[model samples]
Target: MLTILLTAIVIINLLFIYTLVKDLIKHKDEVMSEPASTIWTPIAQVIIYFLSTFGISDFAISTALYPKAKWVSMKKLPGTLNTQCVIPVFVMALAYINSISVGVTTLLVCIVCQVIGAYVGPYFVVKLPEKVIKNFVVVGLLVASLLILAGKFNWIPANGTATELTGTKLVLTGLLMFVYGALNNIGIGSYALTMATVYAMGMNPAAAFPIMMGACTFSVSIGSMQFIKLQDYSRKITMMSVFGVIGVLIAVFLVKSLNTQMLQWVVLVVLLYSAVSLFMAGRKESEA
Candidate 1:
């Protein structure tokens, strides 16, 4: 039953992508003014959407496979859906912060501190300095790289969410996730960070997958809708969405399972490349 539902979702997503791509191509002449648009943007968006839906659906299916935990309430979908909209906004902010932060660790701390300061600390402290922000991003990237390397080398145990959360570690983990949720405004991806935190906490890695996907989907849907409303939609984004949908369907339905270690290595390599790109971009900006 689960497999059938998942397959249906995949098929729907593929069809959605096909429609989007066909429309874009058909209207290419009218949309050609924005030559900067890539042929893949619509496709990517589609994949992101599909994957998000798939992830959420998979979680729901899996949860049904076992007896429901007392603490888990299926009724939280509405609230969860509402919260998802905030992810993209947070991601956008994180991305901007990372670009300017001087150290990646500082950036990570800043992310955590900013969230805390916003809710609990002095409002004045919430507004971090430009230099401080820059430093933090640089440090955060370094830390992320270290984490990727560690995971890749199997130096760290990659467990799932079968462990109970307790004590200081649990509290800290919760705080980090809240901060991560907030930082999604700047375009900092919460997926990798969430995965790392969950893994570090000795939780089931698979459990984190659904949570991250849910959050990402909710945020992106809201943000994308806003973009669309503001007339920010373009052929590039459209193309990416289409391809993204295709990718998601393939990933979720056809490739239901993957080698975690291999996936980790691929993700690590991608992050390393991204870090290098950011560093180089910063260098060029400084040189200019």
Candidate 2:
């Protein structure tokens, strides 16, 4: 069953990759008009690499790119989000493949729920008010990042050796992942939330990695289609996706010896700033 599931996810992800590549080629001429993207893309990818080294996951890139998209076009935010996720999803699936065996049933539940939510998410996000989407991203970033900081400081209790969840805990985790999947459409990431949820439910924190990765892999790939069909994303964001992979490679191979604690601290600081910047941007939308 595990092998079958892995096979399915790999095939699906490949198909999504093909779709994104085709779009990239078809729209290669459509360079983003916003000059700011040229400056922000490299900066954001650097931040993503730093955060990923600390095990922050693809949510880091989503948070980084969403604001950049907002600067260019509010309508493209969702599409930019879906596009940005492709590289991280592929990288994570390969990196975390072994961890999936720890909680196969729970992982399956999350993937199913999140995939459904992801499929329907783009429709709602595109219609949402600019203020609403921006506010959602701000709140999501604040909540998720703060939770991680809180966990580090031992402000939140989460100590469990269990590898899997059962019964009511399983149901609750599924529901939360579904919400996270929907939120992902608006450029909100599920990594911290999924980590928090599974940890609180007494599952091993290690298990959360694979569960979150697998869920996101299926959900984002399925969700990107909606954004593509709507033509609601910026075409130029694809270039940054290449840089994102490079960031991950450097972090994993070149800088693996860096201080993990310091990296986490730096990422938390960036996430907080991102939250504030997004809040300010949201206000600007309201004023405009």
Candidate 3:
């Protein structure tokens, strides 16, 4: 069974690579304007999933290189939000391909955090200045990056959550989710934050994922519904999410094949990149 699984993962990875190459070739002429190439939506989603599986929660990374040139239009954001529920539900229901564990307790925490955050997020936006919230996010990202490095270099003792996940640890995890859920409405990547926080707590990437992805669905759904009600979301871009379903399946295959340690390495690289990107974003915001 394990051998079959590995073989399948390799095959899926190859297919994804093939498609990515094909897109690059086809878009070679127009590479500058759409430097990300054709099939960019899935590429972005894949990178977002890969980096965020730990703490690099960026939605912009289309690949190891070649990211989207800029942010998505806010009108397009809600239309694509459907992927949040679809992918996670597919993952949990399958539960074998990409994740290690999908604990009921973890899912519960995620759901509560996301729903409350989503429902209340607009209020927070109204209350707090956008720049202030973003500045705080930059600081938090730097702190998280340092935490990952400390763990890597053995510079500090383990925070207990890294050793054993207790009830308190779990609730704190949910609170982090709540914060991510709220900010996600404004373009923060929840997956990256969730992955980073859970890793810091010493939970397995597999376990962290189900909780992180599963719960955030509620927040996205709420936002999507609002956009639909307000008629502010773009149906065309939303329809493109269907194109990413294939990539989601491929990602499940790829991640499932990785054990905890490999996932950790991939995640660390992503965390560092995300930290740098956050700093860049902060600088841009400051200049503005």
- Which candidate would rank higher by lDDT, 1 or 3? 3
Task: Sort all candidates by TM-score, best to worst.
Answer: 2, 3, 1
Whole-structure CA lDDT of model 3: 0.49
181-257 per-residue lDDT for model 3 (tens digits): 77665545565566567666776655555565555545665654544444443343333334445555555656544
The TM-score obtained by model 1 is 0.51
The C-alpha stretches of model 1 lying farther than 4 A from their native spots are: 1-32, 35-38, 42-144, 160-170, 222-235, 260-267
lDDT of 2 by residue, 70-170 (tens): 55465566667666667666666656765345677888899999999999999888898877776776777787678778878877557778877789998
Q: Sort the candidates on lDDT, descending order.
A: 2, 3, 1
Top candidate by lDDT: 2
lDDT of 1 at 222: 38
Give lDDT tens digits, candidate 1, residues 42-130: 43344344433322221112112111221112222122222222332233222222222222232233234334422321122125453
For all candidates, the clash counts are 71, 0, 2
Report the poorest 10 consecutive residues by lDDT, candidate 1.
58-67
Question: How many angstroms is residue 98 displaced in model 3 relative to the true structure, after the best TM-score fit?
Answer: 9.5
Model 3 regions lying over 4 Å from their true place: 1-39, 42-99, 123-166, 200-202, 230-235, 254-288
